[model samples]
Target: MKHALILVALLGLSVTAVAQTVREPDGYRMDQYRGPVPDSLTGGRVLDPEAAHDLWQAGEAAFIDVLPRAPKPKNLPEGTIWRDKPRHSIPGAIWLPNVGYGAIAEVTADYFRRGLEQATDGNMDHPVVIFCLAECWMSWNAAKRALEYGYSEVYWMPDGTDGWTFFDYPTEVITPEPEP
Candidate 1:
């Protein structure tokens, strides 16, 4: 019994250690986006569900969802139907897919910039909250980019829609803004 108890405690410790091992990268996460993320972002405020909810209640922040939309495969046979997977996010969030990649094309950068301008009415000082799914790096990248674009008040919600909905916050189906 004593040996079994010691083994269980050691296993618990190992699990805890593993859970604590996610480190923030020096720059954007280039790949493997669906994984643990750091607890904080350097230039932006990291928000939990409750804080995000408060922001939502305040009715000022523009919540931007950066979840990527998968493109239809090019190898599909002619006449094969292709449909984009629908995304549901926090109510009022503007879904700006495909702008969170570590390296983005000039067109994508333009789209992101235009989307932010539209959302904030061209006010760089407007507070903007960027998110995707929990543990997703897309939101981190988007938030970082927003900062680089000179947004003064930027918030990173790493918990994303998963955490928001977990707390029973309402969500709605949203479509991506047209690419610029």
Candidate 2:
């Protein structure tokens, strides 16, 4: 029992020690003393800002933004809310909203298959990046769905829209696309 306690203590200490070394992109060093990342969900890969940018520029990776709803597009006029993810997407990404807010399970395999079809409409396999509102699970579910669909390269960036903008990547806010 004592050994377990000691191990736990050391584990906590190490996380703190490593966190001190993290640096924000703005040249300001992140504080060494910290708690946990606020509202973080696990089981998905996390990515740094620049890496996200590079993958985007290469076009080898597709970006999908998972949002609940927003102002209707100019054409829609009446506007609409979406339960499944839209296809409008994050520039290169095809929108695929997996789970809604506070969902326990990831999105269904069909959701990913559809997204995969878009990602590989021409290519069978390709690198794909999924994300959602910062500190949200919509992206995690979306990414997992990709894996279930047999995608070899799937990245989940929980940083979401906030993180993307934080790093200053170009984003277009568009109305959701009707699924075909």
Candidate 3:
């Protein structure tokens, strides 16, 4: 009986680990875009990074950062500084790290909601693009939440912040409060 139970448990664990779901660290899944993304902000639609960048350059849209703060640098060595400020913000992207941990705190659901509120400014007609470092998930979760929140134009840069920098685009760096 013990062996049978152990075998069953192992099977379940394997299944869970092998799940095809693009489960984000913050619980965001890519499969969320299978349906309609309402015209919440723009009445037309949200734009991706490229288009959003064009709009930003043209003064039509805004880009946002959604990296959560960490208590200890998840990807950095000991004694690394938290990149919390809102500068080098792609000329227009706002910094809103989601569920900051390790060095970041206070990334609650409400935190996300508030950020969205600020992004749209009580209007669902605004276009916003959320991103962070590449091969990451916080930004993915953020973008999906925006879509679920009914924002019309939310772009999840599959490539992440690296994509932006990789393209040799513009960027800004700033100091953040790290809302503990």
> Which number leads on TM-score?
1
The order of the candidates by TM-score, greatest first, is 1, 2, 3
TM-score of each model, in listed order: 0.88, 0.59, 0.58
Cand. 3 Cα-lDDT: 0.56
- Could you give me the TM-score of model 2 versus the true structure? 0.59
For residues 91-169, write the lDDT of model 1, one tens digit per residue.
Answer: 9999999888899999999999999998899999999999999989999988988999899999999999999999999
lDDT of 2 by residue, 71-137 (tens): 3356544546534334333565555543333332333344556656676673546776777766554
How far does residue 31 in candidate 3 sit from its true spot (Å)?
Answer: 16
* Pairs clashing within candidate 2: 20-32, 63-93, 85-97
lDDT of each: 0.90, 0.55, 0.56
Runs of candidate 1 exceeding 4 Å displacement: 1-19
Selected candidate, larger TM-score, 2 vs 3: 2
Query: What's model 3's lDDT at 135?
Result: 50
Clashes per prediction? 0, 3, 30
Note the residue pairs that clash in candidate 1: none
How many residue pairs of model 3 clash at the backbone?
30
